[model samples]
Every structure is written in structure tokens, then in C-alpha cells.
Target: MRFQIDPNDRKPLGRTGETVPAIGIGTWRINNYSMAETALIRAIEVGMNLIDTAEMYANGEAEKLVGRVCRIIGRDRVFIVTKILPDRFSDQSKVIKALEASLRRLGTSYVDLVLIHWPRPGISIEKQIQFLEATVEAGMARFIGVSNFGVENLSRAIRATKKHEIVANQVKYSVLDKQVEKDLLGFSIENKILIQAYTPLEWGGVAKNETVISIAKKYGKTPIQVALNYLISRPMVMAIPKTERVERVEEFRGSMGWRLGAEDIEILEKI
Candidate 1:
């Protein structure tokens, strides 16, 4: 399917002065590496510019696929985001080496954004933040952020990064999972940080919801589209929904270019 992208269908990437597509592609459990390449390329062709992956995903095979696809698609056309494992954040040297390895696997000199996959217990957030700053200074990554981070961890990460600001916080967010809504969402808005919402479809849970189905019917959209649109409808929010099938990639592209009405949003919110 061919998708026409609207220039206004972009959101600010924190303070990076960059705007990315509100609906992005996520690669996790893309076990079929070959199929992932096709889906990702198709996603980009449909104007999905933000591609999310992690070193831990499929033992780095996902990054390799993304690298290959990005090369084919022209790296400049898309925003690349990947994360480092928390265990590697314990030592600064390990952190640097891990990033270098990730770069090599990704076939790129630098990534647009790098994130701490998760906060390691008993590790100094300040030290890790310092290493992240070093990556920026070394030109290994243009921007740095964290994932699955709570409010306290996010606050500490910001305080620790003396040189750079935490550009985004990637976490599991959906109509069903509003854990971040309790505080993190508000905090992120106040701090000018973007919220990259993963699992916006709630791992397929939303597809079976009666309310979402009704909403989709009313909007003449699929349930998944309704779910993704709801997440990216808010300011400073982006949705990265994953699928290895090329057809599903096209389906995700349908989430943009429109919005949910206030009453519809409230109806879904109550579910």
C-alpha cells in the first residue's frame, strides 16, 4: 500500500530540533530477520521514519537487519534508535565498547539516539549518564535517553547529565497500560522530554477490546489503527508498533493523518 505523508504529521524529538513521524516501526522478536527487512523497508516507503531496535533484540540480529534496510533505503531518510543492555552500563569502558560494537553491527558511525535499555540495580545512574555524555562527545551518538525508566530514575538521569538533556523516555504505554500516565507522562511534558511509547497496541490486547472495536468501526479504521492513533494523538508522544509482516506495516501507516475526537478519546480512556 502506498501512503502519502503530511508534513504536519511529525512531532518534536525532545530538544533535538528534529521532527519524526508520529507512528514509527518497532523491531523486537522479529525472529524472521529476512522478513523484517522487507517490512521495515516498506514501512519507510510508507513514510514511517522512526525505526526502533535494541542490541538485546534477537541477539543483535535485529540491528543487523535494520542496518541493511537503512542502507538500502538511504540512512538519511529515517531516524535510527537503539538501546544498550543495562548490565553493560555498570562500567564506563563496557558502555563505550558496547556502543562501538553496536555501531559496527549497525554498519553506521553514529546512531541518531541511544538509550539505556533499563536501569541496572546497584549501579550509579550518574556514572552511566556520564558515559552517555562521553558517547555524544565522541560522536558515537547524536542524542541519548533511557527506556523503561520510572520517574525517580528519569529525574536522576537528568540531574546526572550535565552536558546533555535526556531527549526521550521509551516505555510501554497503551490505552490499557497507563502506568506512565500516573506521573511519568506529566513529568516528561514538564521537562520537555518526548515519550516514545512501545507496545501501544498492548501486545494485541486492544484488537480484542469491544470498546476499541466499536471506536474503530465508528472511525472506519481498524482497532490497531485506533490504538496507535490514540497514543500519538497527544503532544510529545510517539508510537512504535512492531510487526514483521509487510501487510501489517502498511496497516500501521494508516494510524497517521487523522485523530480521535475528544468524546472518542474519553470513551477509550475509560476502557
Candidate 2:
């Protein structure tokens, strides 16, 4: 099936001036390297420009799969993001080495964004932020960000690193888990930090929900499409939904075409 992209849906990610499709593919559970490669190639052919993975995912297997996909499709068209775990920050040398390893795995000279996978417990937040700044200064990543960071932790990290700012905060946000909206979302927006939504569908809730299904019918779209549109339609937000099916890839690309109107947003918000 052919996919459609919206002209205005593409938005700038951060102060870095990089823009990605409002909706893109998330490559976490794509099991086989070859299969991941095929899915990624197909996704890009259908207009998926943003792909997210982490170094710890499958013990770097996911990064290897992403690298293979980039090799087949060429790197320039994809906005690739991979994360460094907090443990690596304890030793600054390891932080740089981990990024080099990720680059080797992805077969890219530099990643678009490198995030701290999580904030370490009882560690000096300043030092962690320093590691991130050092990585950016070393040319290992274009932009620096974080994931799974609470509001207080994110604020601390931001204050600790005066050299650079956290560009995005990847979080678990869905219609079900709206907790992020209560504080994290608002804080990130006010600080100009892009919020990247993971499991934006709540692991298939939107796909099977009666509300989402009904709304999808009204829009002539799939339940997932309606749900994802509701996400990207919001300010300072982007979603990374994982799927390997050909139809789902097309659906994700289609989700970018139209948008959730005010009423649609209200209905989704109430759910």
C-alpha cells in the first residue's frame, strides 16, 4: 500500500534545528537483524524518517539492526536516535567509548540525538550531565537528551549542565498513562524540550478501544491512526510506535496526513 505524508506535520525537534516526520517507526522489538533491516527499509520507503533505538536494547543487537538498515537505505534520509545508559556515565571514558561503539554498530559517523537512557540512582547528576556535554563536544552526537527522567531529575540535569541543554525527554505517554501530561509534558514544553512518546498506543489499547475505533471510522482511518494523530497534534510531542507489519507501517505514515481536531482531542483526552 502507498503511504501519504502531511506537508505541515513535519516539525523541528529542538534548538538543534533538526526536523523529523511527526510520526516515525520505533525499532525495539524487531527481533531478527535481517527482518529489522527489511522493515526499516520499507518504513523509509513509505516516508518514515525517524527511528529510535537504545544501546542496551537486545544488548546492542537493536543498534546493529539499525546499522544494517541504514546501510541498505543510506543514512542521510533517516534521523537516527540511540541512547547511552547511565552506568556508562560513571566513567567519562566509557561514555565516549560507548558512543563510539554505537556508531560502529549503526555504521554512522554521528547520531542525530543521543539520550541518557535513564538517570542513575544516587549518582551526581552534574557528572552525568557533564558526560553528555562531553559526548556532544566530542562529535559523537549532534544533540543530547534524556529518557525516563522525572520532572525533578530533568530539572536538575538541565541546571547541572550549563554547557548544553537537553533537547528531548523520551517518556511513556499514552491515552491511558496521561501522568506525563500532568507534569512532565508541561515542564518540557515550557523549557523547550521536545517530548518523545514511547508506547504511545499503550501497547495496543488504542488499537482495540471502542472509542478509538469509532473515532477511526469517523475519520476513515485505523484506531492506531487516530491515536497517533492525537499525539503528534499536540505541542512539543512526537511518538515512536513499534510495528513490523506492512499495513501498520502504512497506517503510521497515514497518521501524519490528517489531524485530531479540538473535538477529537477532547474525546481522546476524556478516554
Candidate 3:
């Protein structure tokens, strides 16, 4: 089925001067190449175009799968994001090499966004940011950001980048994981950086929440849809939820078109 594009579903991808869908597909532990390709193709066919993967996920097989689907669907129609592991960020040369390999596997010359997968101990955040900047300079990535970054890590990255803006910080965020809301969300919004929420479903935990279930019933939606709407309802936030089943992609699409009411949001926040 052809996916309908919801104009209201788009959000700014940090300072990149680009807008992407608030709901995206996350490829983690998708080892079966054929299944990954089919599921991602269906997702893009349904207007969920912000596709996220990592070199660390399935040892780059996920990237390969994303590449295959992007090739089939036309890459320009999607906002592609991938991460470089923390270990590779230790040195500038290693960072470049890893990204080149990622590009090769992705079958794209440039990705919309590339993120530092995590922070490493003893490695200067400034140095890693510098290498990320170099990737953009080299035209390997259009934007650079971090994943699993805290306030201090984000501050260091922003201070370190000389030319480019740290456009996003991918982190675990959901009704169940409010750690980022305590400070990271506020900080990201203040700086015009997008908060790309991974595991927005909390690995299906939100689907079983009593509050989410009741809210879902009120909206004639599933608890998962209620949980996803809650996150994307907030400004400057987007969710990348992962699933191996193509049917779940359709369920995720249901989260769009409507939003949780103010009272429902307040009730969820209390949980």
C-alpha cells in the first residue's frame, strides 16, 4: 500500500534545514538480511522515512540491509542516520576509515546524519567532535551528533565543534525512560538540537502500562501508539522504534494523524 505523507508529521532535523517524519524505524538486531530489507522497504513505503542504524548493530549487516532498501526506494526519499562506535572515535583516522566503510556498506556517498555511538572513557570529547566535524568537511555526513550523551557530554561537543552544529543527541527516551527529560530534553531544545529518541517503546514495556492502555482505548489506538504519540507530541523530539515484523510497521503508522490530549498527556506524565 502507498503511504500517505502527513504534513503535520514532519519535524526539523536539528540545524540541518531539513524536516523528517516524527516516527522512524530503528534497525537493531535485524540480522536476517531479507527480513530487514522487506521490513524497511515497507516502512518507507508507508511514509516513515527517517531510518536509523549503526555499524555496531549486527556488525554492519543492518547498515547493509538499510542500504539495500534505500537503493530500491531511492535514497533521496529517506533521511538516513548511522552511528560510529565509541572505540572507533578514539582517533581521527579511525573515525574516517570507519565512516568510509559505513558509506561503502550503505551504498551512499553521504548520510543525512552520523552520530557518535557512545562516549568513551579517557578519550577527549573535543577530539571526537573534531573527527566528526572532519567527516562533514569531507562530505561523508551532512550532520553530526551524539548518542547516549548526557548534559556534560553535549556541552563538551558543542564547545568543541568549530564550524558545524551538534545537530542531535540520540538517546533512550520513553514514558518509562524519563531520564533525558530531567535535563537533556530542555538542554537540547535550548540549543536547537533534535532529541532522537531510540527505544521509544521501551522494548514493548509501554504497551503493557495500565495508563497507556486506558489512554489507547480512549483514542481507539493501541497502547504502543499511545506511547509513541506521547513522545512525538513534545516539541523537538522524534522517535525511532525498532521491530522485525512488517505488520508492526503498520501499527507504528497508526500513531500518526492524532495526538494525545492535554489531560491525557498530564495523566501519562504522572505514571
| The candidate that achieves the highest lDDT relative to the unseen native structure | 3
TM-score of predicted structure 3: 0.94
Compose the digit string of candidate 3's lDDT tens values, residues 1-271: 0112223677787777778888999999775668767878888988998899999988888898888888899989878999999998778999999999999999999998999999877889999899999999999999999999999999989999999889889999998777887888878877878889998998899999998998899899999998988888877888999987888899999988887777888788778
Q: What would the per-residue lDDT of candidate 2 be over residues 1-271, giving only the tens digit for each residue? A: 0112223576667666767777777877665566566777888887777899989988888888888778878898788999998888878999999999999999999998899998987678888889888988988788888999999999998888777778888999876667786788778767878888999987788788888899899989888888888777777788899876666787788888777667777777777
* Global Cα lDDT for candidate 1: 0.86
**Residue-pair clashes per candidate:** 0, 0, 0
Assess every candidate by TM-score. 0.95, 0.93, 0.94
Query: What are the lDDT scores of the predictions, listed in order?
Result: 0.86, 0.82, 0.87
Q: Show the colliding residue pairs in model 1.
A: none
**Whose lDDT is higher: candidate 1's or candidate 2's?**
1
Question: Which runs in model 1 stand beyond 4 Å of their true positions?
Answer: 1-8
Predict model 3's lDDT versus the native.
Answer: 0.87
Flag the better candidate by lDDT, 1 or 3: 3
**Local accuracy of candidate 1 as per-residue lDDT tens digits, 211-247:** 9999999999999999988888776788999998899
The collision pairs in model 2 are none
The worst-scoring run of ten residues by lDDT in candidate 1 lies at 1-10
Tell me the TM-score of model 2: 0.93
